[model samples]
Target: MTLSTTDSVATAGTAASEQPRPEYPRPDLDRSARWLNLNGTWHFEAEDADSTITVPFAWETTASGVNRAWLERGVYRRELSVPMEWEGSRVVLCFGAVHHRAVVRIDGSLVGEHTGGYESFEFDVTDFVVPGILSELTVEVEAPADKRAIPHGKQRSIPRDDYDGVSFTPTSGIWQTVWLEARGRTYARAVALRGDSLTGFDVVVEAAGDTPADAVVVARVLGTGETVELRTDPTGRAAGRIEIDAPRLWSPADPHLYRVEVTVGEGESADTVIVTSGLRSIQARGEQLFLNGERLYLRGVLDQGYWPETGLTAPDADALRHDIALARDLGYTLVRKHLKYEEPIWLHEADRTGMLVWAEPACPSRFSAEAAAAFEAQLPALVERDGNHPSIVIWGLYNEEWGLDWDIPGSDARARAAEHAYETMRALDDTRPIVENSGWSHVRTDLVDWHYYEPDLAEWKRAVAAMAEGTQDEFPVRLGPDFVVDKSYYASDAFPRSGVPILNSEYGEGFTSLERAWHLRWETQELRRHDRFAGYVYTEFADVEHEAAGLLTADRRAKEWGGLVPADVNADTVIVVDLIPLRAGADILPPAEPFPLVAHVSHHGTSPATVRLHAAWLRAGAPADGQAAVAARAQPQSSTPRIAVNPFELSAGLELTVPAAPLGGRLMVWATDEEGDLVARTFIDAAEVEEPNRRGARSDG
Candidate 1:
């Protein structure tokens, strides 16, 4: 089932294959004069045929112009011309990412080899390149279909029932930007900056080649104009601290960024690297996650970072920005980048747009000594690469024990591995919190995270109550027990009863949009009820291959089942309703009995306001013309007495009754502000009539 690139209205203007992703790949270290984009069409070869493909799009996706999986080894060939202006400087070939492993050759001479698929790699092709002549560049990629030890994330070798709901199609070969950069012989290898005690930033700069005796590191903060100068040691390492009188914090409301320039030398021979720094601190304090010492409510979504046209990569930078904007429009302050490390542009947009990110590492499917060693070896570099992003507040080590397949949740080895990963991340960078494993079997983690997918709202409420009251062991059943060991271990025994903040990282697997919205609203409300929970991340932002439980379709179209806009269902203050006399989607209602309804009005907004409740009935099987149908059938019912609501207050047990009416009609319930503006609304379809006792009891009981 291959979807065409034109199916998405978002990418209708241009053929993704013709001009896919032409933007500058790296925004943080961008140098217009020193870098060249290598993301257009490239010569490609598979076992069967030689072809051309869009450079960054995976071979299996539609935008690549070859909508077939490159399961076997493939080769990418392109001609590179070193800019005449870069004659004396070193030429570096950089690949944003290549699946599994890659061997690079320049002008038929082997240059370098890299093994990780998610991290960026570069090679110095200066020694082999003829200064003014075009050089032949070849990249041989080996992405073994059956290699379970490689960190393939959700990519499967073959389609299976297990992946039908959550996993996505496999992506192979280059799925990110390819570019060339020219640098002087002595350049700043890397720059790292972290917020220092919430008042300033600590900067570290490393020089690439042999340092001259007069080498000194100069750091300049762009906005506030603070400068710090430090002399490098013999090895070309320098560290300095820059203090700001009044630090501007980064948050979802305002993502202020300060640009920093790090220079490795002085005068005409100086090499400089640009960096964007955000002053912020993320800490887990007693049952809460704090950003800059203030408690934060993480309204987030599970972002798979997949697109219909481009598979693992966005069709272009605009597509990436669109997803982030959609998430924000849906009132999500955070996005959990599930299983995949997205392109740097996505993170940069997140930084600029005030969206917090929970960055995760791609995980392997099977566990082994080799896999563990490989994962550990890649940890430091990965952290170093992404740690500078201000939007990334959390680093997720493992997800649901993907590679730790050896009796996880019951084996000591699993615990040891998780702790080791946590410690490894801590050693590399301590700027953010680390989740040892996201879903279950947590050991030595900064946050207690879990995954639950209860489709039934009443049952979900009960389960959350059990967890909040420390009685989850009594009700043993859960949405997916395998993801977590048992309710007992998760609620009490997973970690010490310390003040660890709990998060329902994954949930709401509904088959329909209405079902998804209802489940999301109720689950979010339940999590809000328990202050111990930091927040919840809905199952997904958009549909992936075979995973239809998304607010948006695979083509980025909004589903009708979702409310008019993101805020209609995901507002900070919203009204929740429970039909006491009818169940969700209940088609049959007793003709003689008056139907009772209960409402819970939760106000998270500031100030007090009066809220009014309204109800109406419309004939069943009405036209499906969306808002027109909804508006036509909305016959106003008698309004309820105005009730004053306060911020962060819950008004429960508000009751109303619907007089018995003819069968075969829909029931609509809505709430309004004092000015009669709609706040939220819900509807139930009634298609038949039944005796009171003949109907199943409400699940809310």
Candidate 2:
């Protein structure tokens, strides 16, 4: 029933307030249709910004109805008239978001300015417009045309950034919905809501305009139909708390939410907003993460939030929901909204579908007082806008020492900036775990995490085991031949830990899709073999531009994994086949004699699971398909019913005999539940030697 980009937006004189995305832009603070969607066609200008481009889609993307090569600056202009029905009320213009910096003007008069491209900003235009007259609205956007530092995130540009090939297309101009909403002359300017077990829900309201001395704030929980009321101050600021009977706890298995409606005043002048919150507690008490009093293992993937057609913006609202659904389908419990602070609609969907999220901001490429300030300044707005969602359990800051210049250990100023960011976020909200400098050197943090990409399977297992045991502290990360040696230390010298919960935030490698699938089992098994790890996020959820290290392509289509589903490797329970390489760190099993079949079984289920290990031999036609890595997901020529059946435990050295075929067959091993569902699997070539998928994917200087 959906159409292509041609029908995504209206053209020319079709200026109806209702755009393609008719839903309220801010679902978290839903005021229904008090807002008119201004996301359609807008007059655009720049060498690259087209004469006319579709709203909410970046100019770089084809969905914007423009063919832009480079995007650094863009000017957007449009004219709109207020609805005749709304006369005496205030008119507010809201930008879902614009990149880097936005300077807004009304009728050539300066209205307001906003920095940071990932968070929403608004301007009240009550005095600037006549109720029924058309007014000209213009917005000027600027990103790094040269090397002027800004939190660019994974956005790659010729001059602004060269974060390997990992980064993708830039998002410039108006990439999100722009709209105008009617509000009371006196309205709630801000609503800060938080939900937890201790307090059912707490909301603080900051109102605008003059308010009666006897004005009151009232909040009601729609689920339980419970309510709370508080008297407002003369300045129209009020705080209210609501507790419902038999509150339902929220979890990934069941994300029960408490939909709420908050009122600021009384009668016709009353201002009301709708938001959703959930009661849950997440803590890293021991060497594990607990969600709602239950232990959790975060099987997460790094989602870059880019698309081939729309670049950084979603082509449609369904696209946002699809990513979450795809991750869930791949047997992942969480999605790390990598680098970019993803759109609010994505978080809203995560709340409804019960998926965990790690929210982050775009990091400036270089470091300075300006860069640090710019980077940290967006935290409050980021938290204030998205904190109510139950899906965002972790707040991640800094990825692989990006904004800090990859020198946190050598510079105290950089380290202090990292610490200050953590402290500032703590001051804003202490409910979620904040990673000071995620996957780099943690000067201060609630969780100790790392990102190591090693292609050698043998070395990878050793490194993962050692790190999990708290032995390997230094992980050398060489950005390129031009950069100095940068090692991601387990912890900074100033903040040594007896050990906090460890998560491998970014890790995985593969030369080809088949090889990636083949090595996926090894890499996943290596991490899961260590019980100390809280979880891991694969290098990516989908490929971005040329950075082809994802299970899925940029278009959300599944990358060919040699007939293997990603869920096969990314599962809660896995059978980690333990075998000595024929040579050093190889994937071939010699055809000399019968090798001892051993497996280290790791299960994450609450109660033990009844499972069986199965072994088989697959004969290939030639040495072509199984040339490098092991052939995976190919039907076995013959099957061994069950090698061992045991209650799920870390059992190793299970007795079995697996002979390498003399002519040309590989040895296959796997684990299955009592019902014969594949939970874990891996294979070893019996004929050819293995080749490693080396890291340092790019060698660009």
Candidate 3:
């Protein structure tokens, strides 16, 4: 079923109305005294109508009480009284995010202007503010209708269509929190924390202003009582390393974080910022991706960061936390934040909740010298802002050749551009692996990835078999017509065959009930059977508008198929089946004909054991009707001994015949251990015959 536009956590009731996103905006570098939350009500003007709307929520969202599309431009005004305590400090006005371009003014004086909708920006408003009196603050936002030049991720001015299936309604005005912070002359502008295998952390602190030579940066590990002091150089920067004996590594199972306090000055001139750090490292060796020296497989989902009522912004902090918890409950170890830079709060939740993140930058549709310059300029600041977060492991640059029209693989221009972007990212931070452009046209990348959405199960099986056999020529046939066969860019022979690890980053048919669950299990097994495969990420975690392929509805409600799979398929004890009789797109069945049903079951549990296969047929009816039709038992199949890394398969075939009838029914198959414990179950439906035909004539006629 399709989700209503207004049905969401934000519109449910007053639960979120009382306090919406009241937490500190920046959790990575937080200072309560130096920060203020401007997320309540503000004077808003849209379409020449004066109204009051929520600050952080975009004007176009229902949460703003102005549930309408934004025009070319909008205005937001708010009056603020600067605290007397911040008299001698630098009062900076900060904006979490504003869609497109924003111009700021205080008391009718222009302060600063910024472009780009996803990153944070701030201006020092100390000169314009009266310490104890109210000051008028105005923000002008201009969101153009053009999608080619702007780096608007999945946002379209018009309704979504086939050409832009993933795009949603455009959001304008300030979509994130606006606040005022007071800091000393010399303060910590940013911090970078790197984790080493030897339980040591290399910390680099960047200060904003000139340093006092005597000023030393003090780093204190809050709970562990570990401290390190380093003196700043002539440039007001300090770098040092601190070792933690026997550190507790951070993983999806245990997301442990260490609190750090960084102080730049001493006595009354001191400025302190609290930071959070995690002890973890990610590395790619040969054909495998490892985390902290252990082989890791990323079972992830695609998160678009959209809300029914709030557009790109989440309704509140609780809403963000709920999405993370939901993904984790469905057996996902990671989430790829697709095509948008999310708020720091979302990454904070991922860090604490034990879910890894694959972060990507928003991209423009058309390429130009100006567009390339804008992307390059934002890369360093983006890395500096989100570098300390432990949850983000993979840094995805561009997606599916969004900006570069000539991003064909072998082209020198495409290769040069991709290499330049890669070098730019590596210069800023060399901690995570960079995927130059996910899905296609891989010039320089650490991991080779692909996006496939073939609905035919047989074709998908063949495609995976070709990958296992290293037969690249036969891949196009098994990949179906939807697969792009252009080898001009990939050069046919040079296309990802060895060295780097390969990932099927996106794949899902989005069917409902039994069909969807069957497809998921079958596709997952196909990838796992290939020895060189690193991992796979399903197409999505929840539905987004016209893209109804998500396992959950757009409002985050679980579908009927949610209960069909095990609690955690990543666990050791699991069974997956690939049934051959239930063909894709085959809804009708012929009765009175014998057919062979083959089931290929893969056992991933510990220890070898015997399992029993049972089959039953039931007429379509409610449970109370008790319309049982037939039952059978196949010979027991013995599975091989449990392997830690690879799954062992067991195949069995049975011949069965259905009685000629007009009634529709379901064929149910179950796999159980020797102790009668249910491992997995699947069903294939048989359509009802309208009328019996004899000699090419209907009986009713």
Candidate 4:
């Protein structure tokens, strides 16, 4: 029988008599079958000493119940009884993920060992297991995160550890679901499905067996009240072209998914696995990213997969889906899963929820040729595992100057390694965007990206403005202290890449500090609340413990700035007329121009009239004469007023109307109550008022 334990297991107290912790191994690919959870009461101990540790969570984590220091290496022992029904072809022991190193043995016989903290590994246990007998399984896991030369991205080094909440927070032991799979002599090993809008999708399936059996790939597009099916060849490589005329694109608003089912084996003995996919293409047309053919904007958030209690492991499927849904609700179309790679379930939930993902490969701190290769080698496994999910649109190889020793003697060696990594990933799946390195160092790339976190908002805004003006590559000198606005500067040269798709990738860690009432004293956290409004967006959504950066609070509370920015005087908070073209004063305009612009304005907190543009005025000019300004007394009573013009003599051919101005008027129209109390306003041409000025600049003055 598989071992088991209670939901919460500790390392010190529980005896070996207790059962395994988690009973089921595979959470994603689940089938109605009898299995055992090898968690619970196991003979566990810290790496070197004889002291016992917990079964699942590492000794250091609170969930593990040990709360003791585990020095790099750890040993765990457990026993299981194999049923008589398993006296068959093959029995595989799978470990979801075992920190930095792992070795497995059954009935005192060595089976297999693996080194890698993020990926899963399995060993063939058929030979070691005695039929109809209790099999004693012992796994020795050596995960020295800080000292080890493994890809433990952001997992703090031992002893002098800082738990500021980033990625890979000492998640040791069997973090994922591990199980024994009883397979037939011939079984499907792995499969990959890649899709794009232009060329048809390809379905490649691989199996392990003595004979070559035909495999059929059947694809069904689900949406628009119909499911379209396409059949592919089972022998060798099979593909089908699904020409979608007007494909329904998947975004935060509309997350559409398609399912492709593959059947392995000849007839009755065949097994089917469903691959969910999305038919979309991401390409840089100049500097803008086009989804389908429209320019795409990525309102993204940095999702560093971490939980206060669970650390790396998610509580359940709903826990994974909750983040995606929250992001969508917060108006973010994309989530840059910063630094670390997430579980397959998170990506799957993203696919179903319609959130775009920029999947970054975990990176190491030090630079070495061999280390790069190891990273490169792990790419195929990662891509193959996550390629089918439509949510993952881009694969981020390296992040923020990690291991870029371009200044060192063998700099080109590292560059070549990076190039190889990039090319190898492209070779596997060219459908999505791949970055050799995300920021700082760049070579051949689909998009340019950078990270900045300065408290001055102006620096970030200046960078954004310069990028909007098509700046690329060059770093501008910092503006004076007076110009600095916010505390962080994470802007990149994405504007030049604007013709291609661009991304803000990272931003919004520092939010306004607000206070929540606590007892007699006021307890203040790093809560993000815009002064003009509170409880709108939020702060520390992800509990970035030390970083103090997030759109949500540590305990998942809406710390202000949570909901949609309510309507107010400002453009973000307020709503004004949707004026397409505000006609110049003297020029004979379209019938729509001379009409009174009406808007169903909404409010945030203040009344409509209270939101007014101070020193607001209207100006009108003539085509014949140069220009003229109209100074009208504030019509406090009327929300919609017809501003009569200073009639020019040329009003005869101009339909006896107002003169045109080189620039449009800045009107202060009062949207008030019956008692002339300013409730709201119509800030005439507040946004992009200079657009008309730029257009007029080209005129022969």
Candidate 5:
């Protein structure tokens, strides 16, 4: 889920059954029964003014119930009626989010406006509203036509440039829930939760409006099981701490959360706000990441957080929960929410279901003063709003130096900008690690991660091995107009690289689903076999338009990996086999002697995983007199007479003989766990497609 939030949408400010998103949106800040969902239907139109699009789904998407060209600017109008009983309270109109920018007005009069599409915003419309009567609420939204030079993230940088492979279909206008709430004149405007699993928790409440000078704030905390009376300061802020006698750590295995309720006063006139958070600590020491003092690997996937039918919005709230479940099923501990401010409910689900996340913001495509300001604007909202969740383990600022023109290494200003963003994020929340620029061009970053999409299997393995050996710094990773392909300067010439965990934040670029699966198995096995890399994130979890590197389709269906299982490849304990023919569809030619196949067990589990090691080598159906050279041989695949080794320790090496069948076919390789499960598998065509020497691989000596 991208940084998207939802609100219950039952009616146009009335409790009706026809709303699309009926769940109360702000699970992070619950004020009981004083809110009304405004998510059903709104007057929507672009420059042409011919359509009525849905509120939560973008105008271009099919789920929006409209079919038209997506325009940059759109307007939404609705008439809201507030219940007479809630007249004495302050009426606040809230929006889960709006794309790019949104301008609010009541009865054709300006109320307020908000910029930035990913975070939530609201306005207190107390004076403008007349209770029990309809009030005209109009929202004018503008998502700039120029996709670049703004924090647009994975959306296409050059508007309708179909050749742009990285960007997906861009969405515009209101794509999240809109609602209204009633609050007391004095209430908790913002609640900041901080602490860890070991010590305790801290609560900082910002009191707003006409809070009495003697108003008392009591927070009935659930996780710590204590009601601490917070001391109010002169600036209308109440701060307190809760100590836990028995603290339970939160992790992917056990995601325990703490419930918080902050009451502003004592009697019936008092107001309360509810929020949820968890306690967990993540650290990196000498090339390994630890959570709750236990070593853990970041088996993460890059998620674009989009759907085919719904451009950027989920059809329903359960889709948010399903994304987390899918990530877990793929054997990933963490999901790097790539480039999009995802759904807050997604973060909530991760908190409840025990999933780690590396959150990122939509990034501008080029560098400029305005772009930097817009890019920096998203940081505080992202950090302050989602900081309370324990599922977020890392904060990512720039991605591959997108807005910086991909020249952070050469340009001091760009490098400083990345470093400055890191400092800004640290100032906001110093609990988790921050990647200055994920993938490469790291001016300042906690993890020395890189992104590569090399399709060559041999080269990929070599790069992975070199990185694991801590020698990858030898290569320069600069990318820009002035960058020379032959340049020799390291990405970080001055910054020290020792002791930091090396990870591949982005990789996996194969041409087809079968090839992608092949790359997945080989690349993953190579990474695990070394056991030196701290972690890796596949290029993506699902395909988005032209970017076909996903292990799953855009609809979340698993892509065929030619019978290879993702869970087995991603398991903490795994078996990896080294093969000469790594490329899919490549054939294995029989040598005069048997070929050597070395397999190793890469286990990151707390305990050793000794599953029964088994292998099946399907020999080609060649004639019995196959002693002759198979340079131009062909054969049928024969699974019979399977080669089995008893208690075969790979340290002794396994020898595989190739016999070409009469017809051209494949020679399969299968690795099984002790429990007879299909832990690992792969295959290569056995015979050469043509006569070998006739199409000589090398000139005669």
Candidate 6:
């Protein structure tokens, strides 16, 4: 019997409510009509196992509300009565994503089965549908944490902490959206864009068919206010060379997307589909990344889609938008969504908000021949699904060499599998950059990636700077580390370059460590100069179980992971405008011993200015001594110009002159005049500049 419409997690299947409709299956095509969101309560039962849980979101996630063990085998059932209008057309069942193995049956009849958890697969269900009553649809899904040769990133067999080297909670189950789309026989299968700084753009339309060989194809470029149409040859394939004069390039700053709608056959016999895209080029020249023929710096952060209540499945479109918005607020223009794929709506919002995206496949723990083949097959579908989103410019194939650990005996097979996967992705879609491996190991691919953790900012900078000078042969590999500055490997002399643009694919792991674990307080960007260091991700977006490395708490509350803050400052609070004093053509200051370089600061506000010294900036790279002090030359809050001085004269030997400011507010002062503004100043004076102040931890004094 097919399971149908039940609210309980254990027995719910693919009911209408279980579909994620708001994701807008077609983002490139504009439609003002509303569709149903089928992502909630459905009837389910394990065909071979014992229990049923929520669909899409993993069984282990809090969103399922099950908190039970991962089900290896299960039968999911739901009911959907098609509208009478769709009588002649075929009914298609579309699964946004399913884990490992899946078999679908309609009206108690076997329909089809698909293998692979990360990519979406669909089948026609028109033959199995009844004319007027509610038809039953059952989907049997099997996901065994088997270790074979699949491109699993970091997923493990059981929910454990040892995920590669990351101590994060385990992930399992569907973990994505599921839905259905009813369409005509000859619909658009895949739409791709290939462009560059030289040739402009070439649109490739891949289609499915068994129709007559004389089918005509047409592609229309939908611009701001005009549409350019191009016709293709008789083989149901089309290509258009578009030369946009001074094209409005798509980047994090201005994401201008061009819409393209293709139609096959003449009016009465035509089938049309729309795909949205942006015309731009991204390539690496040595260690510099060029976007639209200019050196582009990627200011990004790691975004793991999770929620306190929803876990993997987003609560609504707002949740998805919130992630991009938060990243934007933290001065990040790009987001490297780690491991898991997001709902289409997430990419839609990213496109809308002009945020750059680095998309990665979900981390798979088990590997096998079936898994590899399944993975390879699903790549085109994945490209088809998110290709319209201009925000996604990079495709990451492997992360930190996690599941495809090259140390094993079958490592060559797995490595070949990963290479083939990335190669196939390129074959299917070559508009964006493809990362072979995210960290350390070289896979002889388009982009070389690496991971490192070093506390020595000076050393890291020097190494990267040397590479910028072309002392290294290969381009600079991207760096993804757990911490911004790792103390242990800080001064190590090992800096390897394999010829690629250097971007921080990962760093800044935890922002909430201040409250949970003090030792984990190295999640801030104290020494990161945006111009020199390029860009980096601030740990994570939310706290994932034991991994408290999030700029936001598990419940979506904001936390400070990097030094960057929101541009919109509270009118009532003192706004600390950080203005760096630098000389023309001056090199970065050499890192001194582990001591705090204190700057006596005083700000003008309605009342006394008080700042909370978060421990993030005080770890590792900070000075060892703690004797620095700020004093005023003129009275505090004075508009008159005067040099500020350090009370302890710590900056006496520094390049610039130091003066003291008159005192206005006490330590952690409370200001008056809620609306009034005050001018404040500070001075640094000390025999020696001590390390940044630390709370709870032992002091040098």
Best by TM-score: 2
Tens-place lDDT digits, model 3, residues 401-447: 66665344545665666678888998887888898877756777888
What stretches of model 1 exceed 4 Å from their correct place? 1-19, 158-166, 210-214, 473-494, 562-566, 578-584, 587-596, 605-652, 655-701
Native-referenced Cα lDDT, model 3: 0.70
TM-score of each: 0.86, 0.88, 0.83, 0.67, 0.86, 0.71
lDDT value, residue 39 of candidate 3: 64
Q: For residue 193, give model 6's deviation from the true position in Å.
A: 4.0
- State how far residue 295 of model 3 sits from its true place (Å): 0.6
Local distance difference test, candidate 1 = 0.73
lDDT of 6 by residue, 1-701 (tens): 44455221111232344343335444554321212234554565653444555656666566665554456765666676665555554456667667667888877788998876667677767678754567777777777755234434444554432354453333455566555544445555556654454335566665454352445566666553334455444666666665666577776667776666666555543556666667667776665566777665565668777675556567666778888887787556678888767777788788877988889886444455566675567577677777667688788876654445332223767767677877898887776788766754545455544344433434444554453344642223222344222111111133334345655555432124432111112122222322233344445666775666676678778664222223211112221212231111111132332223232222212233323221111122222122211211122322212233321111111112212212211111111222332222111112222346776997679
361-384 per-residue lDDT for model 5 (tens digits):
988887877888888888887777
TM-score of 6: 0.71
Q: What tens digits encode model 4's per-residue C-alpha lDDT throughout 533-607?
A: 011111223655465555466545554431111122122222333233221121123232333444433333212
Q: How close to the true structure is residue 686 of candidate 5, measured as C-alpha lDDT?
A: 51
Clashes of each: 0, 1, 1, 74, 16, 75
| Cα RMSDs, all models | 6.2, 5.7, 6.9, 14.0, 7.0, 10.0
What lDDT is reached at residue 108 by model 2? 89
**Decoy 5 TM-score against native:** 0.86
Give candidate 5 regions above 4 Å deviation.
1-18, 157-163, 212-214, 474-490, 585-595, 609-612, 618-701
Task: Give the lDDT of residue 182 in candidate 4.
Answer: 56
Best by lDDT: 2
